[model samples]
Target: MADTISTKQIIKPENLVHKKSAVMTDTTMHYCPGCGHGTTHQILAEVIEELGIQENTIGITPVGCSVFMYNYLNIDMQEAAHGRAPALATAIKRLMPDKYVFTYQGDGDLAAIGTAETIHSCNRGENILIIFINNGIYGMTGGQMAPTTIVGMKSSTTPYGRDVSLMGNPLKMTDIVATLPGTYYVTRQSVHKPGNVRKMKKAIHKAFEYQKKKKGTCFIEVVSNCPSGWRMTPVESNKWMEENMLPFYPLGDFKVPEE
Candidate 1:
């Protein structure tokens, strides 16, 4: 009988293309299949590791699918009430000025119930990062329409489709935030594809770097897909988001401090 070669001895470690970030805990993510939260968390973990701020960073998670972020990311984390992440983050940052503070919020948490908190915190020029994941609908709350839910977008609340005339226009929160004087940097990105993922990673890195500089609110909005909420498969949601969501929430930097 021929001797079997050991697998570890056959493959070189140098050829490895990707590895899990050390900042991410072994805890399994609880996000729905094809949800963007997992990818977003991975990128955030990579940024924290690469910036060498893993030990000094503090994250605030709001009431939404992202609430589990504290368990997945191997860093100090705090939980806040629905739409209250910014408020909690503001206090945390004020108390621990030396720490890298950030908030992970969903569309519903950031743009709806937490609207006041979100606006006030950014307006105050808090030196913290806001990672907003916008999937248009309230993903974790039985797919109800959210403040960011676009026209004609279907949700449990809008079974037929979103009627802008009756429901009000979709709130462009990122654009609104960018216009505020306290916001030092703002950008919209996605992570459905490899190129977009790379771009989003860069944006996250820049946000963290700016945070260190004490730059006022660095907001990064991730226009992501929610297959479960959208009533589609992961691939279908990605394609639909590309065709429908991207046009309204265009990707690219919306604001940056002038040198």
Candidate 2:
């Protein structure tokens, strides 16, 4: 008999390539290599898959680095004007109570320009999830000063460091949102490290669960890294977030409504 080669010996193209995480697709993300947005996006996608809400979820993309978020998440999404994601999410959730609604917003979009929308949405007890990304500077706007910019941090606009006297201190959205009776769950987490990433996933899951219960607004503020805006390499950006940002914005659940 002729020599027979084992079928197993044949290399499979799929096997040769590394397996991609279920949470993320093979599509190349536009975020900077070290940008925290990619990590947070993965976590959110994982949570959606785990909860089996991907089909029923609708995400609102705000005008920021995440304006292209709809391109990444394989779910129904709508683009909202700058800082208007909360208002759009509110209307969507109100109309489609059976569907899951969420808004992905940045510091400048949420804390500065959309402050009114964010506050009113939370105050009105809107049943939606708000994923607020606070990276201290405006990533998409050429590193401009943001409402959440830490005191003494320098940005393109604040070339000489953030002046608390003239610009005001960093706004703590999680703390402010938690105070609203309409808010069902409020947490602040980060993606600077593996441990923190795990915690952030938990917080994201919890926010979704709260929405499932039709409780009220659930807000999760993620202290993310903006390497391009921060003018640091991806590795250094993560490290900087840990050393300088975490102290001001600790990661943990700020509030959870009682059953």
Model-by-model lDDT, in order? Answer: 0.92, 0.88
> Distance (Å) between predicted and true CA of 151, model 1?
0.5
Over 197-218, each residue of candidate 2 has an lDDT whose tens digit, in order, gives: 8888888888887788899999
- State TM-scores per candidate: 0.95, 0.90
Q: Quote the positional error of residue 116 for candidate 1 in Å.
A: 0.6
Q: Model 2: runs farther than 4 Å from truth?
A: 1-25
Query: In model 2, what are the clashing residue pairs, if there are any?
Result: none
189-215, model 1: which lDDT tens digit per residue? 999999999999999888888888898
Instruction: Name the top lDDT candidate.
Output: 1
Candidate 1 structure, TM-score to reference: 0.95
